[model samples]
Target: MNFSLKRSLTFTIILGIFASCSTSTEEPWSIEGKSDQEVMAIADSLAKTFIMVDGHVDLPYRMNIKGFMITKTVEDVSVETTGNFDFPKSKRGGLDAPFMSIYIPAGYQETGGAKNFADSLIDMVSRLPVTFPTMFAMANTPADIEVNFDQGLISLPMGMENGAPIEDDINNVKYFFDRGIRYITLTHSKDNQISDSSYDTLNTWNGISPFGEQVIAEMNKWGIMVDISHVTDSAAFDALRLTKAPVIASHSSCRRFTPEFERNMPDTLIYALAENGGVIHINFGSTFLSKESRDKFDKMREDLTNYRAENGLSSDDSVYTAYANQYAIDNDVYEDVQKVADHIDHVVSLVGIDYVAFGSDYDGVGDSLPKGLKDVSTYPNLLNELLKRGYTPKEIEKICYKNTFRVWRKVQEVAQGLQ
Candidate 1:
């Protein structure tokens, strides 16, 4: 959990570049209508200078459930497939680094779920080099990402999306760190020993649990980035107030766009995060973006609950995920990646361009991404849309990767100070 890492190349480059770039804003990507090819071309142009980092991905799920080999290349997404990310697609999208998630299902909250899930995730990443030696490599820091990119490798940084595995054991956090986990989200949908979840039915600590505060302290000691996404609003505020280092939302959107969704952060908190020198990576999920889409998705969930209850089936993350995934597919609910750009714009408008980044939530949320951003490689289309919307190359670079990198360095500095 030690956050001390080597200096990032992008951090050094953008600090100097931003001084000279104009801060003017105008729409770049076509919001009304634009062809896919046109958007792709704009994305390509933006891709050349941008590092194109995706803040969050759930590739480990492919390994844990669907038994996908990390070394293999997956070309398409279907119900039977687990891998949504591959070397081919990333190269095409001009993506440089992806923070791969080792998300533990909440089911693991009891018994030894966290330990087993964490171990499984460790095994999953450990097998990546052995299975797909040519495509994937473990990256512990932002600089590692750049180094891997230089050697033509896809850098994968391990991030735990839920603190379920820690199970109130502070020492276990160290185990996660040793396994290459760089960040730990305090909670998931439901509150656990660590803290309250944004989507959890139980209020638990009614906000930040006692264990949650200790978790943050340990994470800060370890230099693990504290991820605020999926945490309750109170937990988010408490964590923000508690942490000495800058945090990252990892994959969250503006509540303004999609109100009442616990997964989306409010504007006041967004500003708070920015003021605290944190970053909010825009999530690509439509339900996190559009109010209408969220409501539809919720209704589908209610229907699924009713059906499952009648059938005497209990609902868990997997069942709910399946239902949500299937509903998105059936309903054709897709969020346009351009909407992602709008979120970036909103964050920038609130606290300047330095506080936003891209957290695609790939594979984590099935098929409910913005239009034209169907998978890992579809990111360029988003960048293209940003370009057409008038984002300069430097500004685009900041949003894509630089911003996150800076936050990491700042967090590292705080970690050092704590030590």
Candidate 2:
């Protein structure tokens, strides 16, 4: 060949080699062209390799009501149960640390005994390690969780769902923290001494009460996270401004999807939370995902309320209970797991992947969990859905636990500084 022809051929050969190298260097497990099984395997592998921390799980409260005798070794939580969380499911789903919710009902705030009720729930959680020594351990800090993860034990961190238990005493914050309570949601379904709730009609406090402000300060000093999940927008804003450490919405979703739903955090609050260097762990309830589900569920609840009023029945009446059960069965609606991922996507878009995490609200949301994520074992399915949505493994890891861990570590640091 002539010199010019040989030069052109050489250039073409070099270009072809570069193209081959580029193709070979591409990620093998990216969802772009992989089969469903390949994506699933990738999800499963990621789930197991990383430390998946769900910000909230109400297992202790659920078992407490079931009369399961959690203090004694009744049954293996690692095995399948009728509830949403168990040991086997947790392992399969790769959930390393799930903060056990020590939920105090709103009614307890009025009838008193809120503190006692909280203590009982805490006792139940404390007994888990004793009951199942090999499978579980109590985690007091981010470091505890990592150590527990290394030991192949699930970390059971505690987060009180309402501040009513603290009642009139700011010292209770330190009391509970010493009891291994790492976070405290200011209010639940109704306003209490701490702050107004999203679900209650009363705006008693407008925001955090003076006592509640002291409580937040004490929680910050004690290194306890302040959870803003069920508090009103005003209360949330107050918390965002007052908290010395990063706050978390432990089990809330994006209100953008289900507009007018106060239980979920709004876009403004989410942005503010991100600004505060905190994390929003998405709740996986159907009504929390879509406005349609919320409307349907609200209609059912309204119908039940109307029926009870018309029949002059109390909330505890078996007749009203039966009617409510039938209503739920007749109007059941399930949200696709993709909706949960969509909320995650929205948070990531608004703030970054660093401000979002999983808080699945398992066992607490009853039967309203999204379709593909019905139980603890289904986290991989949600991860697969995210993979398909183009979330990189690093982004997924941040969502899984890193973001929350960072906030948790920050809270600890702030507490040390305050001291």
Candidate 3:
């Protein structure tokens, strides 16, 4: 070969090497920004491209109370509503799959009709596809969420927020699983047959009732994710030790932030959850995120309870309800959206990003949502905050959906093994 031709080839190879090096050294989209707006645009793009799966959303319960007929196609969720979640807002925020919370009130545990109530809520979620086939569909697995994402439809996976509906029947786990319920929170605000709750002073089972242990095992055997959000610290620890598969704090934040708030997971539990290959989806409620806000809210509840006792009024009394609402308005306590990201940062700093995800308790937290994340359309804002805090696009993607998907797939694999 001629020397000139050899030199030309060498030059081409050198140029190609340099170009590859340059591309590899370039900053990720998350960090390659000159201004807040530029970073926000990058965050927005990432939000749309990635699948964001919120572990809990109480849209079904919210709509049920408002008398919004779920069986009929009267008003589409694609349009605006007075609530925190709607199809249009979800699309705008790039939320692809939000697990519809079939939340059973703690009162149902004593009402004797918990199962019937849970079934009705499940029916309400099941009717979403029938009512609006073009915009929404039901998802029972991680794969279903992927398919719905590809088809440009939102997936409404259901999670039973309280285990009272299981109704002392172990088979009810399989029944609910067949009905598309992927997770069970075991208990709500109060202790029940399954497990003790953080809010309840009564430590009935100490940690988990004997039946609660069976419920966790059955959940593992059936591919249902065991949720430890509202469970007491003892119960949460018990769940961690017993489950064969990874569990999830479906909608809880770091108790490290709000010191005595048992509703949030403590650092040790968070670390244990991470070591167990589980994830803690951060709740976006103001009270959950801020110690001051939680303290004030607690004081308000205490005051209201005292007033109710003095007036000889039940909790369901109109005057008591009106007073509670008025007091909340009078106080107007809220946390900044940055605080929500701060919880994420706490988890990441402690256990890395893979153990964290979003579980904004939208429609369930009432008017106490963090400032910038008041609705489903505001996820990008939180992503922007993460980006500003040096989270790469890949890390953000993991927090948005990949981490939860990993746990979900693991639970399914464990089920397969049991079978």
TM, every model: 0.82, 0.87, 0.87
Instruction: Please give the lDDT score for candidate 1.
Output: 0.77
lDDT of 3 by residue, 152-250 (tens): 889998999999999899999999999989999989999999999999999999999999999999999999999999999999999999999999999
Where model 1 places Cα greater than 4 Å from the true spot, the runs are 1-42, 70-82, 299-332
Candidate 2, which segments miss by more than 4 Å at Cα? 1-29, 68-78, 300-332
How big is the positional error of residue 366 in model 2, measured in Å on the Cα after superposition?
0.9
Return the lDDT, model 1, position 108.
Answer: 78
Tens-place lDDT digits, model 2, residues 1-419:
44234434644553343344333446433455557886788788778777899999999889788844354454545446788887888899989999999999999988999999999999988887888888889999988988788788899999999999998988899999999999999999999999999999889999999999999999999999999999999999999999999999999999999988899999999999999999999999999999988888778778888898999999889988887877776777668899999999999999988999999999999868877898999999998899888777778879988999999999999999998
Any idea how many clashes model 2 has? 3
Report, for every candidate in turn, its global Cα lDDT versus the true structure: 0.77, 0.87, 0.87
**Candidate 3 lDDT score at position 82:** 84
